[model samples]
Target: MAKDYMPPSDFLRALIDEDVEIEADDTATIKRLLSFFKDPDAANRDWAVFLLGQSEVDTKAVRDALIGALNDEDDSVRAEALVALAQRDGDLARPHVLEALSAEGVYPTVFEAAALCAHPDLIKPLRGWLKATGDKEVDQMVAEAVAACEASAK
Candidate 1:
């Protein structure tokens, strides 16, 4: 989604307005965004989760919603949740980052989260992944994540 573009749905648009109004910390907006998690369209759910991730609210409701979103069917949504959670708290993001690293596929957002958290536990898996991926870009992402983890380890 474009930075300035809002979702075409009226409800989503209103939610965006409310997010802007309260700087994304309002209870009602958060509740509606949480409800949107159940939307049939993955895009809507993804967008809703993305908005929730951007929220400054640190309530248990928001954190639980982000953690729940890690199980979303869409990879991007899960990635966003991981990144958001990592940005907020390294301890909270560590296990999930390890799990994502152990997963079969290469997810760039997972690397992003790994880099953001820079926990020592991630270094081993990141080194194992180095140059193993056929995709150079992904390998580079792993390298950077490894570097971040190593720096933090030191």
Candidate 2:
């Protein structure tokens, strides 16, 4: 039997609630999340992009929203948007990825995106990141991304 469904009155709280599972076809929830992009709080925008990117909701509107978020002032938001775009459409994300990878400090999530992208073009930047970020975890991630890009080239 299908259980009764009630949407949360507090979306932000619900966003972080472990017990609150977002349904795949929940357009209302998706719409509310999209609206969060314009929120003055950077954390709200960050959560919006991160959730949308991590979701299965694939739409042109979602993609465009993610793209727009790439320009967000918050680095985390931009990184989440880039990861979402990279996961959905590598071709559309390549230029932005290259630009982001060139930044003095690339976000960890962006490295995850690079791995997902697995584009040969990302190899040089990944190599650069491997040298630049002295952290062992980040180096491991960059190595994984480089391996992914290399594997894709074959």
Scored by TM-score, the top model is: 2
User: Local distance difference test, per candidate?
Assistant: 0.80, 0.83
Candidate 2 residue runs with Cα over 4 Å from true position: 1-9
In the range 1-154, model 1's lDDT, one tens digit per residue, is: 5577555556776666773443454677568778877777777877787777766767777778789888988887888889888888878999999998888885787888899999899999888889988888888888999999999988
TM-score of 1: 0.82
Q: Model 1 Cα RMSD, Å?
A: 3.0
Separately for all candidates shown, the number of backbone clashes (residues 3 or more apart, or on different chains) is: 0, 0
- The positional error of residue 99 in candidate 1, measured at the CA in angstroms, is 0.9
